[model samples]
Target: MPEIAGYRVSRVVGTGGMSTVYLGTQLSLGREVAIKVMLPEALADEVSRRRFENEARTIARLEHPHIVGIHEVGRTADGLPWYAMPHLPRGHVGQRRLTGDPQRVREILRALLSALAFAHARGVIHRDVKAENVLFDEADRPLLADFGIALRRGHGTRVTMTGLAVGSTAYMAPEQARGQQVDHRADLYSVGVLAWEMLTGELPYKADDALAMAIQHAQSPLPKLPPGLRQWQSFMDRALAKSPRKRFPDATQMLAALERVPLSGGSHGARLQDFAYGAAARLQRLPKPAWVAVGLVCAAAIGLGMPWRHLAEDVADGEAAPASSASSPTDASSVSAAAMAPGNGGIADGGAATMHGAAPLSVADQAIERARERMRTGRLATPNGESALDSLLEAVRAEAGHPQLAVASTALLDALGESATGAIVAGRDAEATHLLQAAARVQEAASPSASARANHRARVDKALRARIAIASRRVNRTDALRLVEHARVAGLPDATVQQLRAQAERIPDLQGRDPGNLDGMVVLDGATRPLAAFVSPVSRAGYARFAEVTGREPALCRERISLLRVLDRRDWTTPGFEQGGGDPVVCVSWKDAEAYAQWLGQRDGYRYRLPTTAEAASLAAAGGARIVSEWRADCTANCSRRTVAGASWRTDSASRTLDPDRGYDDVGFRLVREL
Candidate 1:
């Protein structure tokens, strides 16, 4: 251990299970570097030693900036293997989460993906791509490190019976976890898991043990991601698919997918930069008095400059006696003399003296007096409990002419009404509803002259009418439909309209069929282009998995495109997509899928979009019935089947059959470009 040969060891920078990383300087080139030396125990095994040496040599051949640069590799004085790499000045990937801005996350992914694409192109597969393996440089640029587990082409079966999986459990692709042969697609899967963790702060799958986790990855469906992530879901889903072929064909494809995410609008990087600059400018413009107060407080805590006794004496001389207090004549004369003392220089020279004889209060004293008065009357309590309501009433009476306060009072009353309406809808007792109504009335009275007061009253009436409609629907179907029609004229949002319609449709009508059947049904063909103008359908399993990952309901989850394709002309009226262009968009990633659907709505006259999960399940069930075998029937029949080459096709009928001879491994889908 006489300082590794050819390098001057400075200090131990980091240590891992099999190696010790030291800060070093290469004497030959006068360059700083990180020297990683394999542990003696690991080197004791001849096979492990050979593997380590081989990996180090393999890494040395990599030349991408995003990949950690391996400068040299050789044996130490005692025959131990050691390798030197460029020293990265920045810290680990986990450190970036403190700010948790999405832009930084994207930048990290971009660099990592670039590195992966480079390696994949060179026929190298880095089996491990988790956050911990990714390092950051001084400029917050990401650098991939620890290629020890990387598998190179022509490397004969390196699997060992160590009982430990090759990749980290959380980021392992399903096939990899099952000990199946893996390719570059496995690496892409790991990157996808890492990206999901960075953006949403949670893994899509979790279990108590590694075995359970492996099972989840192998058998369980990809989880539904967070709502509003409609843009990221498709990429994430493809990357996390249960089968290797279902994932990106290779790292290059994944990189292209990453590029397609909408980064120009609402980009996390631009927003954060704007926020930081604004905050810095605001800090610079703070008043001098505030700065002085902060400095004084800090100084006082440490018993540094300025005596407490002197500070108290100055305060006493500057503050006037309270109007309710009577001072003795002798004491008053003493105070006057103290203020006029020659040692004080003059009234103009000392601020304390100027206020003394004038009987004017210091700003600090006035502030304290006002605070004390407010405390006595409890006027500062917030609007949560009993004190809040009392304070609200007083504020309204004191500032009746102030439009803002008047509006605030009215808003509070309206919120109360809404809460009551929720409780009633949830099946609370009549007594509880009566109590809530009483509370709303009292709040209404507090701001009688305000415009909000009228709004609150109107809201209460609407809630009552809604409740009546619900009651009528349970008893008489015809009347309920009429009531919902009436509500429509009053300007309800589409969701509300749909809900009302759903309720009316539920009752069995005169035709002997459930009236709800007339509301229409949405059908989705997974292989065909997604419906351009209907609610996007998702598999029930997909929806449940998504909820588990994001902690949000399926309905709230945003839709995304699962395949690469243009919108059909017929699908322009979907919920979220509402744009029109005929370009062959390459990066039209899944999250953008939903936006495209919504955009289609404006081009066409009806709603067009991805089917909801319920709709997707129904369609799948129907298709499943048509095919007489397991959906996983070998790739020969269903060309659209999830497989590596299937990534290219928008749809492949050859994939839909049960006969293995007729299947093709590369079939999948693309959304319709137009109706």
Candidate 2:
């Protein structure tokens, strides 16, 4: 190991393509540390060197219980970039003896996902998430390590070399492997690969070289787990989906699915059936020559008077298994025999093949067939992995550039749209929104025209806005809050979410302070105060309630039997025209309006005042039309004359100054509630 300042390098512990990790002791702290030094060649370019430093600085700022923290970062004596971290001597999850322990797997996945969730929340994506990067402490707790290839949100795709993505091919998301931009979901995909490796003791896809491996990741069908591990198929399917949109939206969602994974290993019969499924799948993969050779060997052994059935029974008793094999079959011979039973099409459990004279089904064909089956079973877009839409989406990816790609994608989109419609009708707007979003993602992936994409997006937005409107109208505060959360979970735009949130948040203010009068209100968003106003001018019934409760008298009117005004024998009770209780109460002066508003505010334990000229204009712009000109709090000349706003029965002018102490035949007022 190269010498480092303030530390004594002992020996090289591990090495990667870009960096070499050494076991060293910091002299000042007297603690062992893992010093990771960038390879001289990897940092030869100025762009690479700068990206390394920028990522290092970003990583150093992250502090989480399950995330490895950087101790110090600097240049080595040879001018190579390097950073030191706490040395975890217990090795990593790759070396751990898992023994198919689901509990252990759950624990490891949880810790790593927690770390990822934290880092992602801070705009960091751990582009390289593999078993080797998960280190174990003394307590066997997994800590996510090796963020050397991490990409900060919006840090630009130039952080990596021009044509290469920075992640292991076996664990890399397809999008990342294509040298395309990636987000946190890419890390979740890698985690799925790691989980597969842990449970199956092998990578899901394999090839002779890196490029071939990446192609397999991009094109191959998702691998099926061994029968005993079938409970995780749903989780695995989502985690390994070709499209990130189909996968768990984030680390937290993945963690939730992980937690829900069944802990019990199911009944023996179910396991045997699963084993038969696996055996059939394995048999289907064998070439014709291999199958013929196996048949010939069995025939010869039987013809030579070899007791093959007895030998099979002996093997079934577990006497002839390989010592190095970790998989000890419990009843394999019988299950394999059953897997090839007659009239079963050389398979079991409706497995992928039909064994017709035609060639065997390709991976994409199998995926499409599976999707059809799922659709038949009414599993279009649920249960994450086994859904019809999920199968169709993966098929689209596996058959990229194929003629049938469009067919499969169209099916997927149609299913998603139908499912979303169903969800909306069922009042599951959040689920509906998720489905619509998935449809949009599918269209985008297909590289639709800009107009097509925009049209699809507009449809989605309209649906979400309708849901927000539904939530906004919820009479109960709790129901409104729940719907708001649903809107957020549905992945509504931030602006839309804020709108729904504002409405939901005002529920308590409206219900508690203005019970039985919650309807017909408009919220003015972004105002300093949480303010709402009556949608129309306050009606005769509302004014009458205030007058009755406070025993307030009607004001002198422009045309009424009053001493100070025109004696037209009319007041608020009769505004010189026949009117209903719901109609605007005309012939009310600004002071009478003010008194009624104050009385209503006192009755409701809320502050109610006449709308300012600006507020009234906003209400009108928002479609809160008024039948009569409303009184406004705006005034001039020391409040001698108050402003009247809005259209009236007599005129459509925006505003006209009126005397505060006098009433008019065509004037009324609305109340603004301060929340």
Best by TM-score: 2
TM-score of each: 0.39, 0.43
Worst 10 residues of 1 by lDDT: 579-588
For model 2, the superposed segments whose C-alpha errors exceed 4 Å read 268-675
Report model 1's TM-score to 2 decimal places.
0.39
lDDT of candidate 2 over 1-675, digit per residue (tens): 687777889999988877789999987558999998988998777666766787677668777789988877767889888888899999988887675687888888889887887788668888889988899987878999877778887777876767777788989999999999898899999999998888878889989999999999899999767746757877898889999888877675566567556665566465544333333344445554444443343344444544333233223333332333323234323333324322233333344443223233345655665665465344656788888667777776777664555654565555555456445534655676577667766675653344544444444445545544544433345555555554444445688778767766654444554333445676654445556777778877778887888787787666334664444556788777766455678888888988887887777687888878666545664454456788888998888888887667688888788888877888888887876
Scored by CA lDDT, what does every candidate get?
0.51, 0.68
lDDT for residue 518 in candidate 1, whole number 0-100: 14
What's the distance in Å from true for residue 345, model 2? Answer: 30
lDDT of 1 by residue, 433-482 (tens): 44354445445445434454555445544554555444433334565465
The Cα RMSD in angstroms, rounded to one decimal, for candidate 2 relative to the true structure is 21.8
